[model samples]
Target: MLFPIFLLASVAAAATGVIFKPGAWYDGLRKPGFTPPKWAFPVAWTIIYLLSAAAATRVAGLPGAGAALALWAAQIALNTLWTPVFFGARRMALGMAIITTLLVTVAAMTVSFWSLDRVAGAMLLPYLAWLCVASGLNWRIWRDNPAVPRPAA
Candidate 1:
């Protein structure tokens, strides 16, 4: 029921990454030695997204889940914003901002979900971990490509 819907929304958010792929612009930029391979982005994102959606679904029916669901919405909205800001517009700084917010919101959701359903909270553990790596990558990318100008709005 809600699981599929949540999953679909995650998939929709993920599509933005595919549509606004890193391409030559991303490839040309310097990345951290620890950056994961290009192919790993989609694969990792797919699993992360699905797990997050399931976590949301698991807690959606709980009595005080309104706040948790709201956090979920915030995280997803911020999640959707990152791909466009970072890749589509080539605005690493702005992308970093969005990703940072995403990291926090996801964390908030994680705690909220945990309070409601530990399983749901646990489901997002991987996403929280991944976002840590992603935030570092975003910061490093912005640092490495200092000369690359931010795209015009």
Candidate 2:
């Protein structure tokens, strides 16, 4: 039950990607040599999100889970914000900022979860690894697409 609840929340966040797709703006970018194939993003992210939700659920009832779960919530919110910032709004710098925070939150969550449940911590490893990849991608895109305008904040 706990896992399902957390998974549902993650799915809702993941849904944002569907709404704010990488359309023509992304298509025209001079992607790095390491840019993943078009089909890979969704595939990788789906697995990562599910694992992250399950990891959070596993530790949600632990004695010291509050901070961990709060970090979970924060990271997911940042996760949801990325697609809109990067793809929908085309603000790569802001997206990078969001994801940078997300990366830190996720690393903290991984450590926090490890203290409570090793298995749960292990579940998040791929997600952490993937975030590293994503951060690199975001940074590369920001660097390569210098002409892209960021909205005035």
Give me the candidate number with maximum lDDT.
Answer: 1
Please, what are the lDDT tens digits per residue for candidate 1 over residues 1-153?
A: 899989888988988977988888888998999999878888889889989999999998889999999999888889998998899988889999999999999999999999999999999999999999999999999999999975676
Model 2 weakest 10-residue run by lDDT: 144-153
TM-score of each: 0.96, 0.94
lDDT (C-alpha) at residue 15 in model 1: 85
Model 2 clashing residue pairs (backbone): none
lDDT of each: 0.91, 0.89
Residues forming the 10-long window of minimal summed lDDT in candidate 1: 144-153
Q: Which candidate is the best by TM-score?
A: 1
The collision pairs in model 1 are none
> Clash totals for all models, in order?
0, 0
